[model samples]
Target: MRPDPHVDTVDHPHADDLHGDDPHGDDPRTGSAGHVRVDTAALGRVAAAVTAAAVQAGDAASAVPGLIPPPRWASAYSAERAAEAAGHRMRELSADLSGTSASISTTVLEYEDADARTSTRFRAAR
Candidate 1:
């Protein structure tokens, strides 16, 4: 019956600190002097690596059924089918991860390009 940790509760202790306030000084929402830093190149590289690892893990999982022979006992008869299903699901998950990684990479590139353009425009104005 406990509240979900991910959902923000209305009665949170720091909820009042997010907006305009002079009680404790600075606003919690805005960064120092309205500046933020992002490193898209590093993010893209890490995502790419995660994609590769997912694919590799899927490939290894798919090969597991072939590596381990099923037992002759009656209890193990259902286990073979379960193993096959797991391998198939792993491959599907791997493909999904790869697509997500590609999407993130594209987003990172676009974000970096936009940042560069913005910086260039500001420099030109000066």
Candidate 2:
């Protein structure tokens, strides 16, 4: 049978690319990297929402231009920069969704699901 495309049957995507201690996923190397990447998709939606509210609240939409998708990077940059102060914020959104690996793992039903361990206290009471 043909294998699933999303399966971890092939080379890891971000293994070589990711550095030490990545909190979002397992660290390929020995050391742990605490660099947890926030869900950009979530961030984008929230940012767009707040921007929309600003436009509705007496803020000129034309003066701001696009609402849902700001056609330009500069406009989004200023807001993103403000949101993520001190850190270098990139305007481009990450396509990788959260819990993808977990989803893939769960889909593989071949995993053992024998049964939960019987509590000794309950067994003794019987």
Candidate 3:
């Protein structure tokens, strides 16, 4: 069966320190440093774009005619999804990079490939 492009937003906890690190901590210009957790349930709206992108990527892979099957590099898909989640988190983060602009602390961006499996995590910096 073909994979579904529509990714379900699992019941993940809303976290400010998803990245477990903060960039704009104790900014004298920003007044104070803190974290803002979000309602994962509300993540539905934010997850839409990421889901679509994944579907597109998958479709693109299916179209490519290569010597071998397109690699099932699951991390690539997961990263795309997490990136979307990060975008959502960035918006919800309460930092004024500009008027109504959420300046989320840059989190740890890393990718690891495991034999037969792969994953990527985008932890939002505190």
Candidate 4:
């Protein structure tokens, strides 16, 4: 399947740092010196695209059994098994995509919440 054009698949410049052992090195809550900006709108778009793809994959999986004819001979039994396996894999892919979409949406919400809390804290401090 073709990748969604709306999703930014490019790796971030600080991608490595994000997974580094220094948990507080870039954490905003720790008064870190670095900043990481999140584009929540873009993330929402990505989540939507992933959800659509998951639906398509689920539909394809449902149709796989009908598309593959029943084995008429012993030689075709292997082919039938393979088709069943493919269908199973497609179902798994659909589930994974749905999970990924949910995770992305959750990330967007977390970022927005963090921004709002930070803004409130700054206002209270002033």
- Please tell me which predicted candidate would have the highest TM-score against the true structure: 4
- Candidate 1 least-lDDT 10 residues: 7-16
- Candidate 3 local lDDT, 1-126, one digit each (tens): 222345421222223335545554532432335322223333434344444554555454455343333357987667666666655555433122222211111110110122112212443332
Q: How well is each residue in 1-126 modelled by candidate 1, as lDDT tens digits? A: 344565422221233454534465433453332223345656767788979878786787767746366568776778777877888888888888888888877877776676777778879999
Candidates in order have lDDT scores of 0.64, 0.37, 0.36, 0.74
TM-score, candidate 4, is 0.70
User: How does candidate 4 score on lDDT?
Assistant: 0.74
Model 3 ranges with Cα > 4 A deviation? 1-42, 66-126
Greater TM-score among 1 and 4 belongs to 4
**Rank order by lDDT, top first?**
4, 1, 2, 3
Give the TM-score (vs. native) of candidate 1: 0.61
The predictions' CA RMSDs to the true structure, in order, are: 10.9, 17.9, 21.1, 8.5
Ranking by TM-score: 4, 1, 3, 2
lDDT tens digits, residue span 1-126, model 2 = 233454332222244335533555544452333222223334445555544454343233233343354457887878755644422112211111223333433433222121112244447789
